[model samples]
Target: MAKPVQLTWLTGAQAIRLHDAGLRPPRGPFAYALVCDVRDPALAALANLALTDADLADERAPSASARTHFRARRSLLRALAAAALGVSPTSVRIAYDSDGAPRVDGLPAFVSVSSRGPLAALAVASSPLGIDLEPFDASAEPVDAVLHPREQAMLAELVSTARARAFLRIWTAKEAYLKALGRGFKRDPATIAATCEAAQFSIDDGGPAPLPVATFAPTMGLGDLIVACAVTA
Candidate 1:
């Protein structure tokens, strides 16, 4: 039987410590989701962790802050994947697909990642999955560029604050779904329909059926971020 999905929340420092201690995820048909703060200073030490030449080539960024964030996120992902596969972090090789989605070499697990500001989210599952994170902006409103007509009409009915939250819920859901499909924005956001009601979230891409999408409940320390995950189900 497939294992129930496990969700892990970690700081960059905690991830580094866990990796050093050789901690691993539960085995057998595992699906894991991890969310971390990539801005943690402790992650800087991870720059010394073993990375493929390709990974090193891609590490070059225009700004120091961007480089730091990239290294932290990549290092955390390698740590998580290594733990999941019960291998050393250095043995885990990461490659990217044409869509720029990260893939663990020789591993069947499907992986997806997203980040906004200091936060990063990762999803690794037996089946295809996608995860997205976005900071909550109370003043942000739905835009015509990305919203479906139905979504716009739905948001129009809500008050300002509610509209902002609802827009993010929809936006993240759509992004996650597209990522799951491995198409990203190649599929127009304006063409996908997404909805979040109460504790439930759903997406309809005009396929034979709606996609399975979920919105993570607001955690104490992450109250200002909107997180969503989509998986084939």
Candidate 2:
């Protein structure tokens, strides 16, 4: 089981617009992340149009499919940030810091962006956070070298299909935490011990941290993708 995700599904236009919606921290137990399908021709067009000259250059620098993915996700990312901050979409500039984590200019909130194929995700919180979206593939490698001893034990208890789900779920959670740490995969996965049981995932990331983490299947109706979000405790 994973924490329930209270997702706000934005239309392609809302995702590309700058409105009165301004940046605010999520209240209560609910953590927020915006998800959109950029594969839609309409959304893709808006995303391309939303791109700044710099964004276009970055998009063009990637391979064909990746270029499109980058543009779509970044487009939505800008719109989401702008809406939250009540600013023009073009006024919201995204710059990568030394760690390569995306930051919205002049905002104090922590932001994370992820896209798999056409589905894109963005999370904004007052504390440092990370969010990841990964499609489940039984054939993909699980556990990898990042497996914590406790997580390995948890996996050993599952069999068949359940085993695969648990493996991917745990991986997503761990990756999310690493992102929250602001270093991404630049750190060893083993650096944070991970275990998933029931709907909650816990980790001993070697800290006396103060934020909680939530992992859940997204409500975007994207078939078999799983999402996990981590925020400061």
Report RMSD (Å) for each prediction in the order shown: 3.4, 4.4
- Work out the TM-score per prediction: 0.83, 0.81
Minimum summed lDDT over a 10-residue window in model 1 is located at: 1-10
- lDDT measured at residue 167 in model 1 versus the true structure, 0 to 100: 90
Candidate 1, residues 93-146, lDDT tens digits: the string is 778789877787887677788976457887776666788988889998788799
**Local error of candidate 1 at 116, Å?**
2.3
Pairs of colliding residues, candidate 1: none
Candidate 2 per-residue lDDT, tens place, 1-233, comes to 12233434443345444233344434543334766677766455446645777667656434788877887778767766655555567787777779888777776555787777778778765556788888888765456588877777777877877878888888888788888778998998876776655787776766563234577675545677777888763
Q: Against the correct fold, how does model 2 do in TM-score?
A: 0.81
Deviating ranges (above 4 Å) for candidate 1: 1-28, 41-48, 217-223
Error of 1 at 31 (Å): 2.4
Q: How accurate locally, in lDDT, is each candidate?
A: 0.73, 0.68
- Candidate 2 deviant stretches above 4 angstroms: 1-31, 41-49, 209-211
Clashes of each: 0, 10
